[model samples]
Target: MVIHQNFLPLASSGLPVGKIYLGYLFIRPVHNPETPFKMDVSFIKHWKKRTTLEVGHRGMGNSYTKCAVARENSIHSLNKASERGADYVEFDVQLTKDKIPVIFHDFHVMVSVAKRSPEKDVHQIAVKDLKLDQLRLLHLDHVQHHSNTPLNEQVIKVTGENDEAEDLRPFPTLIEALQNVSTDVGFNVEIKFPMVQEDGINECENYFEHNEFLDRILKDVFLHGGKRRIVFSSFDPDICTMVATKQNKYPVLFLCCGANTRHQVYQDERTRTSLTAVNFAAGCGILGVNFHSEDVLRDHSPITKAKQLGLISFVWGDELNDKTNVEFMKKTVGVDGVIYDRIGETELRSSVFMLEKAKKNELFSKKIPSPVQTPRAGSVHFLNDQPKIPGLNLSQSVNQPHHEWPISSSSRRRSPTVTTEAEKYFAASHGLIQLNQGYLPQQLTTAREV
Candidate 1:
């Protein structure tokens, strides 16, 4: 499948601090992972480029809304993501009883009240049921009810009163987050709309009408975003459609739970599978689908299908915490972007890839051996599985770069090669190799094998 993208820049150079820009994208039908591949159908047209964008999930990091220092979705957490050089700081935005949008994660948060009698009563209150002032006066020290931990164990509040400890602050309004976060960093606004009941019962109460909810938030973003790059997303297909149709100022991304989505109470038919999301987003003229990592890794046909339809693709899940999983997403699955918890660590690992590229470049400049010349740009190759190493195969080359030579743990043998300055550095760095003039380094010999 041929995948392409036209990057619609949010602003000339930097984010418009109080404004948002939305663009259009298309998606094609994705088949099962095990299905045979087929040609892609024509979709939308714009520009065609492939680049990986990084988004920080719920600020720099979160342990299920319990970040180590800053409260998840708080202003402090958002700022930390920006400081760590994330292209976008993603957070959940929900409404209060007064129709105000606040940066919060869960639908129902535990509320605690301590009275003069030293007796405290706790209740699991839906965020939409409380006025902004009432919500503000109550500290956000409780966990989501889905945590399964007892209510008593969930109320551990940040007790210190330091400026950096802004986790102690009450939940922040959407306007506050927009006004305070850095102008250069973008925002991935995940709108938290409640789901429907399985038995056809109305699951939510005291909530603003869908149109009103969308309108209020759009007005706030227009007034405060100031050309900021805003990518609106939601789990609800209807909400995604509303955002896509209501305005053209920002892109809409459909967030899918996919096959391995855990702890879900109810499932919407439109978003039951990644394939459904691909079709739904395309029909709605939405830009992309942010799938869970399990969905993509299990069967990357969706990524291919999305690309064929001229749609942008993104992945987010706990699996992204491992750098290996992240590399696989970028190198093998070929996603447009990934949202992970450890933004700093992921970015650092990405830099290591750059370092490897630099090393390859240095080797090429020094006229390294023929078996391992720098593979063409945007091309990835793997070492042949044969017992004997074979030279490069120009015919097998593809657009993905770096034909990797993995040292298999089961293989205790080494391939011999002529030594150069690059080999000398490799030997010195690993301390397993001994370099000699015009001779293969010890690191390249069998002596270093386990």
Candidate 2:
């Protein structure tokens, strides 16, 4: 649990040990009543039921590389993902020069400026340097690389200067997304913060102060995120810590590149590997770790370690685009969620939470017969004539007739009745069930007991 002294300067400061001081402003940890020490696992309760969530990456897909329906992080992209039945939609959020939280991915954006020649001169500008109005007035392109790398062939043209539709435009405000997107779909809000790369280059020079930066974003979310299932994540461990301390309504996940060969690793020690990220997350008392697909594909033991620690495991990266890899993570590797591009393109799937809700409603609507009491001593009773409900796991009594519940093929493949320690922890914490106790037949009869 050692924090680098350089990351947090506390020398000669009169503030508390965990409190961070930036100039004259003191940042103190705020306790959330909902989740005092850990994140509220109720958001992803279905994960324990073997329902691996499908989160749309940057909405429908990353527009720069993938063939997405709309610009990445745009309002249209998020709404499309919701319509496609994605359980959750992940998007990057950073602050504009005006301190407005806006959805965008890269730290730098390529702004097309008019020149004397026919072709417009493109300039790479840091997103934080531009005001919201100024950013909305520029034709922006995704910056792939600084060393003359060609722009992506599939890049969605973001014409913020023209009279384009609001939904199709890039840099949609955070408040706008909270209001317009479907409430059924959860949000995996990745807080965008600049960091040092493995090559000793800073992602963005002279970015906003961490404390002030997080404050503004948290303010927006707190004010606008009404009853929405939200989870905050960040590659910067400090940002994750700040977010976890700032609010209790939503959970915080540490985003780790892990052991990836596709991109240069970050300089942060906490993000060097999935194992280290897990240790950091466990030590920080956060919810879980979002490991890159490369690391998990290389060695899935980290996910096992995460599960053992009762932490939620989520995988993200370009490797998730392959259907086989997605299946491997979902079935073989056993991750809680997968963040990928073009969700529902390979095979259409509904949100696991939504499906579970429907199943609960259907199960409760029918009258479940109570177990018949037997007058004979030392003998088990059987409900041989009771009709079994689909997708419901009925308790089996000794010497009773074995009845198999009819379940769809897809349901059997995706979800199993087997429970995990993480699920037990959630069920106990949320008062859904008593720890180390099996569900009785009567418990299944009520929605609250279940």
**Top model by TM-score, which number?**
2
Q: Output the lDDT of residue 217, model 2.
A: 86
User: What TM-score does prediction 2 earn?
Assistant: 0.71
lDDT of each: 0.65, 0.75
lDDT of 1 by residue, 46-66 (tens): 223436767788886774554
Mark the regions of model 1 whose C-alpha exceeds 4 Å error after superposition: 1-50, 63-69, 115-119, 158-170, 197-203, 346-450
Number of the top lDDT candidate: 2
lDDT of 2: 0.75
Query: Distance from true position, residue 67, model 2, in Å?
Result: 1.9
Per-model TM-score versus the true fold: 0.63, 0.71
After TM-score superposition, the amount by which residue 200's alpha carbon in candidate 1 deviates from its true location, in angstroms, is 6.9
